[model samples]
Target: MGWFFAFFFLSGFCSILYELVWLRLTMAQFGVTTALTSIVLSMFMTGLGLGSWGAGVLTRRYGQRVGFPSLRLYALAEFLIGCSSLAVPAELAWGHRLLQSMTAQNAYSSGSYYLASGLLVAIILLPWCTCMGATFPLAMAAIRSRQRLESKRSFSFLYLANVIGAVAGAIAPLFLIELYGFSGTMRVGTVCNVIIAVSAFALTLGGRASARSSAPVLTPGERRAVTAQPKVLLVLLFMTGLVTMGMEVIWIRLFTPYAGPVVYSFAFILISYLAATFVGSFVYRRFNTGGEVDPYLSWVLLAFLGLLSLLTSDPRFPLNTPLRVLLGVGPFAGWIGYLTPMLVDRWAAGDPDRAGRAYAVNVLGCILGPLLSGFVLLPLVGERAAMLLFVVPWMGMAFLPSRRQEALPGTRMGTRIAAYASVVAALALFFTTKNFETLFPDREVLRDSTATVIATGNGMHKRLLTNGIGITQLTPITKMMAHLTLASLPQPPRNALVICFGMGTTYKSVMSWGIPATVVELIPSVPRLFTFYHPDGATLLASPLSHLVIDDGRRYMERMPEKYDAIIIDPPPPVRAAGSSLLYSKEFYAVAKERLQPGGILAQWLPFGDEAVQSSVARALEQSFTYVRVFRPVEENGWHFLASMQPITERSADDLVRRMPAEAVSDMMAWGPAATPTEQFDRMMRTDLTTQKLINRSPDTPPLQDDRPVNEYDMLRHWTHYVHSGMRNWKPDQYGAGSNPPPAGESAQKGNE
Candidate 1:
């Protein structure tokens, strides 16, 4: 029993580690759209369901006839999962090359592209994930062969150990990824799987040739009676899987405003869910009586607890970020943990074949949950309404006849009263609470498959928010992103491209030059709200010179054939936002370099970051391009990095002004502290800082790359810094005691407006 517990604990850790690394690797190969993410996850779950059912059928047919050791089969499954750490990455890279080749010959439409990539991902991941699913049923069969009494509750025992390992996996892997890269982290997972495989094989060395079965083969009539009783229990298992996974997607969108969209925030949510689940499973194991809790009462409690998220997420509620997540998601997740394994135990009754089929049914529901939430529910109904829809199913199920024995006398009356009160409370929460978007007085809210976009505020203060996180506000710094890069070109610009269309200021400024300007935005709803920011937005969008592309900026550059004289990228704020590293990585720079005309400059906007992030980004650009320059916009406090293959020759403010057309010059001064183009450029020139100065700030930091997102995972470094130098005394922008100041007369204020 101890050996089985240890084996499952290690196996669970490897599972989560593979999931985190594989998801990131796929995003780098395929485009980083919501649809692509859903495809990857669904394919993974599909493989799990197929593997569980297949392993069960094989075991039930051959275990008694062949006299084979089930531990050997369990060991083989672990060995294959370990080997996937190497095979999966190589397969994904090959798929990427294949797609690129096919698109190069004949461009595929968006729907066709997803279909092609999804098939490729399914082929690459299914076989490996199938092996992962086989571990559970194979281990359960091994337990049944050796210890007959323990086999009756084997699923719950293994589930308790697996979930404990999952909680550790959620928190510990971030540090592993920080110290080693994604590939290196996968190597660590491979080692753990190998250890589990070798240990399991060792346990089989002294086993008997003919294993004793747990229960006698059932008669035909008894088999039918056993199967008939568990039909309702399997339905409950499927519903639990669907609602549990579906709400996880909604929780991320609803809590991003408070959590700030960092990797730690995601970890916090996962840890809260798994840790609470561990407590629930532990309680069930320790306190189980002969009579189980009534299924009807459990359903009623789940519905009531599920609605608590509305109260916790309301704008008027005054709770901290972590507390809000724990309170909102913890109770519901813990209840699910208690119900799932209990239902499986009741259905299987020590039979591995029945347990396998029941678990597979639940996994099938898990496959569709995220897809339904992301593509259908979120896009059509928004977050608050979507949450209510998930709760409705549980409320409906509470009225169904209970399959378990009737409760003792007097308990039925109390149960009905509790159910009525809970249903009333859930309805009250639905009508009373205000969603995050409704809290804004003047706002136009739009929902798409990608995100919930909000355009709010009055004139000159208009802002764009994606999923409740404030993305950008109206500002002159956006105008400078276009003008400064174009004017720095050695030759007159013929065309330009802008990635990330926030408030449409940069795109509008680029169009003032009368050159063809293309803007690529990830969210479809964001471009529709462009008219809310500028009165002339519709007029500009209608022009032949303006082109709007709805796609990921990095992926757009990879597939498109067009080259631009100037390419400007303004990533969303907070510098450490999850996936923001994709825009700043060296791999993205290499792709941008291939799409630039001669002397074309790439302007990267850094809203705000600490010295470590600044140095890592600077080092990546320095390695990718021959020449790089850094400038601080007069209207904003962050740096603007300009990189090009050809040297950017020095020019005075007057010379820069002479190069721009009359319309471009007029647009540059429209929202400026300087009344003239020359004065605006001169003010920008005064704040010029060297790229080397930034690199010197954090000499030991490595360049940012797709495999190593230093910005997203920095907790260890921050903790070490805090220990050596008190965090209260160290400010993020301060250069410490001896570091040189920014160019003379430059303001030291640290964030974008």
Candidate 2:
């Protein structure tokens, strides 16, 4: 019982720690956009597969030998895992910084950032990943040798214990990493390794005097291990692995927009697998010795139900309920865990000594499943389709024959009614909720449901209000706003361009100005989805004068040919995903200048943020262009900047007010708002104070790009800074909880004059 408790805790702790460290480094170094993170995760699986294959060789070569000490071996594996946690972070930081510097200098313009990120990721991942992968097999080998059992009872029982441990390990990271950051999570993991090493050593030292008797070796053919049932079981487990991998990626994709601090997001999955494993193992331990059909029958039923649930459930269902519940407490584990003993019973048959070999092959499937899913299914077909494809092998498990059959004794009448009702209910709900999000689209829609709008700019002309001031004219301009602004700009405006293409309002504005403008957007679904929700948006996107390129704004600027007299960066706030971080990076500024013609004006719109974020951005701009001046349009929350390669002076507040459209003139007449006080301008001027401080205090963490490492913490800090800055600048009834008002519904839209 002592040994059982020790192994269970150690196994769970070590596995979860390994994953937490692995995921953190992957997300940080590779930027959040790529699918390669999945490839790294699958390495742990590969390691398990290799570990399983090598276990037999290890046990046979060292089981009874004096030199091959099991206690020392266990300690060594734990130490390796500890060492991996530290080394992975350092390596990730180093490689990420190197790429950032190279890209910033234009030293590697020939290759895309994605390619560079991938190559750097490969160098860091391959070695540590392989080492991490080796632990599971080593663990299983240690367990089998310690027990040294002849009966199926001991083998099944010990294997069942290991399954529980694996499940526990899988679930631990979700909570630990959340409470503690990744660094703290790794520290917890190190302690787990030490405990495992110490306990194994203590157990071995106590049992040293009792050497097990050697059993006669058996050949593969002599054992009659080539049974059809176990083979079917193996296939079922492997298919489950595929589903598990696909589910993980799909879940992340679905959750990314709504959730923050999503590291422990896979907890549901871990828990579900754990529950299934516990139930399956417990049943097998109770009934396998008696050759009762109940154990095998339960496994079949669980797998069938799990697969059937998946097939009938809508992939884009509004809620993550079914997926989360099944992931935490479903048949995923029943498939992965039950197969191990079933294969052992077949291959080892009556010979307990050869059972180690059967267990190793079972571990191999764990490694292969994720790798195949990441590199093949995920990138080729979307996550939704990959999940649908998992059902084929799971259904095949029904036909396998076994020594016992445990059929339910239910009458035909009861079974028929349940089955019929299930079919009708599933079909009815599937179609009913398919575009359910259109009813209410906002932050709440994302918070409570799975419905994601591909293009938000389309449906309504959402005003971009900052600090209680509207900047609608600064973003998607209407024909009236564009016509007015273009008539006002100094002539030779034939080559005007826009950095953001929100709802094509700015494009309409630019077209009215008679300048051919190009717009860049990151999300591919945005243009199309917006077209569905907003009819006007569809026409603007297909407009003759505008070209909408689905590319990062900074990347597009680096390669674009037009030398525009005016380039409007009417971008959405930095609060959205990676968009905010990319905007502040020095690399982006360098590219922004390269696209601008001499004496060209660059307009940047910014929201209120803390000293750090605001100043960091100001410093970034200062570093890029010679003339950087801040502007506060007459409206509230309307902060703007006109930067240039040439020196420029700020115009008087009265002149700025005078140079407005009629509505803006009307608003100015109505409000008669005071100019920003001298104190506020001084605060704005202090934006350069912390640029050097930030650079010095920051660890040499690389600047984020499509290929750069993503620092979720760093980005979160940026948001926090933004929030604080907003609070500092807040006036009564301006941007806040209930005190400030919400935007009126889509209709009576007043253009940000």
Candidate 3:
């Protein structure tokens, strides 16, 4: 039992690691702008479900009839899983290439391309993930044969080890990412798989795994114990799998804003969930040894307490507020954690045949859950409403007494009614404490497969949040972004590509140039929401010259090499958000450089939220571009980094204004403190910095890399160090490397406001 525990533990860890990285890799290929995440997850779970059934059949028919031990088969499954770690990366890279080729065809829209890529990913991942499912059954069969463990004990001990390993697999990558990049992490997973195979092979040499003959058929007493209420048990298992998996999807969305959109954000929630689940299962292993199980009423009470934990979690709680965040997320984590493994233990009873078949049924429900949440629940009712919907069924489920519970006729009606009212009171608390949509204004909420887009405020005051993170806003600050970079160019710019369509401000400003423009936005809903921000959004969306593309900025550039005069990258803010690292990586700049025409410029927006982030951005820009210039976008704390392979000449404010197309000048002044174009240009010129000089001050500043993402991970450190001690605004040295940067000139003041 000890040896088998170790063997399964290692395999469980490798399985999660592979699943985590592969999912990220596939999302990159297919574009995770829709419910594509749900598709990939569903497909992976579907493979697991099918594989469990197939493994049971193979073990029953061949292992017993052919006179071979199932433990040896477990060894082979581990080897195959090991082999898959190598194949997966290569296959995903190829799929990305295929997606690139397919995107060039005018016949296909972005939606169809995503669908095709999804199919390719499914084909690549299903085989390895299916092999993952086989481990549970094979190990169970081997343990049962040894007679060192009974049906109940076998599943509990094995489940405990698997989940413990799963907790590690889910979290280790976040720390490993700084040491080893995406490819490096995948290699680490392959190594773990190899360890599992070797360990399992050792187990085959002795112990119950060594048994080659089939055991006698179960006696009447054992048969009855295993078969009792099999139908109800299966149904309960399915419901748990479905509800938990569906809520996991919702939880990821719920927690993203609190954790930031960083790569590790999802891992934090997963770790919390698995950790809590391990606690529950561990508790069950200790207490649930006998044939008797806790009644459903007790489980219902726990569920109510869990709902309280979730209801208290403010949806818009700042990521930096740890206590509030933990309080908010704790409830859901506690509820599912206790119920899942406990229920599985009861249904399977450690019988290899029953365990394998029953676990497969649960996995199928997991497959459906994500699809149901992403496509049906999320899109139809929105996040808050969906959460409320989950509570209704959960509370209702607890009210119905299980078959095991025998109540004297009508004796406990008052007690039951009070219990029901308590559940309703918790629901009422969640509703009265509503309106955490502070991430954006309360104008309109739009839900799609990709994200829930919310628009708030009115006219140019509107803000946007794709999911719960503040994405973009309608403001003149955005207008200045287009004019500042374009005006800085020494030569006339004829074409431009706006990488992110944030409130369509930069895109609209570019169109004001009246030149050919291309706007590439990742989320489709964001582009569609432009009308709510800008009055003329409809005209710009319909413009022949303004080409709006629903594709990833990086992927779009990869598909088409430098074909524009200038490209402005206005990525979503806080600089530490997930996927932000990819945009800031040195490699992306290399890709962007290929598409620029001669003397072309790439303007990047950097919200100087932290010193590390500011330095990291500067370092990356320095590494990529020959001539890099940094400007203070506002008098307070934002920056604009203009980088160009072509030398950037510093023209006087009047001279630059003279070169602007008449319409471009009009766009700059349209929403500014300045009454005229010259005044707006003067505001941009007041805060220029010699980029090389600023880089000199931060000689030891580390650059943001694909592997070591300094921007995304530093917030954890910041939350601890700066939050405790008052955070100081660490401004870089003087504009000319004088160790003191003068404040933005008074002339730029009105415009900044």
- Residues forming the 10-long window of minimal summed lDDT in candidate 3: 732-741
In candidate 2, what are the lDDT values of residues 251-359, reduced to their tens digit? 4443332222122234544556566767867776665665323333343343334433343233354445435346423655565455456546555543323454454
Cα lDDT listed for each candidate: 0.82, 0.48, 0.69
Which ranking of candidates, highest lDDT first?
1, 3, 2
Point to the candidate with the largest lDDT.
1
TM-score of each: 0.94, 0.61, 0.86
Q: Please report the TM-score between candidate 3 and the true structure.
A: 0.86
The best-first sequence of candidates by TM-score reads 1, 3, 2
lDDT of 3 by residue, 62-180 (tens): 55443456777788888888887679878977987777666555346556766777788788988988888888778777766665536455666777888888888887777666456
| Minimal lDDT window, size 10, model 1 | 735-744
Could you tell me the lDDT of residue 488 within candidate 1?
Answer: 92
> Model 2, which residues run further than 4 Å from truth?
1-8, 60-67, 97-116, 147-181, 198-229, 250-304, 307-388, 396-522, 527-753
Model 1 lDDT on a 0 to 1 scale:
0.82
